[model samples]
Target: MKQIIKIIGNPKIFVYTLIWLMVLVVLGTLAQRDIGLYASQQKYFSANITWLGNIIPAPGGRITMVVILVNLTFMVLFKHNLWKIKKIGVLIMHIGGLLLLIGGGLTAIFSSEGNMVIEEGAQSNYVDDYHNMELAVINTSNEALDEYTVFDQPILGKGNILSHENLNFNIEIMSYLKNCEPLKRTAPAGIQYRGMLKNFMLSELKPEKENSRNRPGITYRITNSGSSIDGIYGIFFGQSVSQTAVINNQNYEFIIRKKRTYLPFAIELLDFKKVLHAGTGIAKSYSSEVNLIENGIPRRVLIEMNEPLRHKGYTFFQASFIEGLEGETTVLAAVKNYGRLFPYISSIIMSIGLLLHLLSSLPKLLRKIPGVSPS
Candidate 1:
């Protein structure tokens, strides 16, 4: 057993394992082989899933496992022998890289992202936009504190949603399709047919074919107090309104299509500034002045291309630019990641290791110098 332990704990074994990991990563990346299409001037794969598929299949190359294993091996091989060092900067940078990888893994597992678009003077209580899958809670009551109805169906197959006290009816997720345009369908008999739902709608009933309708919306019906209101709502990039229905004495409708439950708070863009290099029409940099209203207090924020504004366990990144009648607005995408601290820890470790490695080598080199004194 001692021999086996030695073999498993050998530094050479770690090196070999690292080499195999590199080989697999290279092969996995190469398996996507569409250089011609990748190099073309015109691009088409805009959706995240499509892009993911093009790079790595559903099984996802299995390279992540290799990465985890290699990192673990390195960590185990050098438990407490990482503090003796010389170059602090190099050590910090190396550790920073490892931290970044750990942060990335955490982001992949527990990060939530989405969008919320409001009219010039409108106010949104939820983040209606999305870059990935999320769980949303629709609050219907028009009070200071409204009751919420939660939906956590990541992929559409078979799901049942419980009705809340504020909502008139519960929701059932029959099917879900990504990318493809959904086909419209007629509602069943006895169930009043609502208007056609589009892009982002919740349906009271399932359509015939999952992807038949190119609509990325939902359609669901409910009867509150007695007045039955059934209609289809379409949610897209631009400004659009849902058909109003008076159910019971209170009106029950889906106003915004956003993922709200996971969010800690909200961010509103109050103003923006774009700077350009003089004498050359090229743009230099841009910044967005936003109002970060959290816990009932509003704070001014500035978010630039590379510089991000972080608050309340969420990081707001300067994702893109938008030019509109409001005198050029900047778009800042919000990201909420639970594993942000891991990067800091790993960065410290890697930095210390690198410094020790450098310092340990430097003394030997200096001693070997031809005329060097032992002072």
Candidate 2:
């Protein structure tokens, strides 16, 4: 531990880490041309180690960041001699940098961002994740309210058996295609295949540039379920219908859709207003007039591009609008981040540190000037 600390504490390691981070940025940008932005970022910037063709391994952005963090921490605490009179400004600057890093860590871990779409006069309480898929088993037996049990992407991997305490039966996954295409079946399938699966077959397709555009499909066999309700089940993204199962005298529908985050409050779109650039179809600005309903109470608020509605740590911004035959659909980009104030706070701290450091050195600078005397 002592040897490790000494190596990280060395001033040269900080310089090396910065150089490595710059290299990562350049390489990651270039890699985006081939593997796309999301893929490149995941491999290079997100992961702790980047593998080259399943053989060679390289240090990733996270690893470099950790190194820099450790080196900076040592520099601030030990090397600079904490609580020194003359080094106060430098220590404050280091503290600001440390705070920024901590904020980044918080954002990376606790942040949630997604989109909420509400048509004119419609209300929605959930936001759909941009890239992750979720298997929703909704019990529609109750007339009053439906019960939803969701399985996130981690459990929906290929060949995984899904069994929940709330669910009566077990689901044995046969295939889970990341991107799939559904086509009309030429021949009739067995009795086990039901619903949309009977008439259509899902095949693998090349993934789309936008991860959300990729329609994922799942094929699974129902087990521990009786003969009537047991069979091969299939579901896919954007499927209008779902595979129905009767368990314990309750009707449950299984559908694979984008993961949803249900918020405490709901947003009802009252009006969608847009202004076009002069003589052009492009929108200069767009805004959504929505009723923010919380705890059975409604409050009118306008969400715009520049001015976003922030409530209870969630921020809703007017991202885009879709024109439809019935009504206009407003897409609100919702973000909930614990570290939202970190950047601004860190910037202020850093600025104060820089100003203080400059002022502290002003006397020496004045001494160097032959004509200027230190008062």
Model 1: runs farther than 4 Å from truth? 1-24, 27-104, 113-129, 133-147, 158-168, 180-194, 197-215, 218-250, 255-258, 261-268, 276-283, 294-297, 326-328, 337-351, 361-375
Instruction: Give stretches of model 2 more than 4 Å off.
Output: 1-4, 80-82, 186-192
The top-ranked prediction according to lDDT is 2
| Candidate 1: tens digits of C-alpha lDDT, residues 326-371 | 5565555666788778777876777676776676677678889989
Return the top candidate by TM-score: 2
Candidate models: Cα lDDT each: 0.50, 0.87
lDDT measured at residue 247 in model 2 versus the true structure, 0 to 100 = 79
Candidate 2 per-residue lDDT, tens place, 226-262, comes to: 6576777788888876678777698988889888999
What is candidate 1's local distance difference test score? 0.50
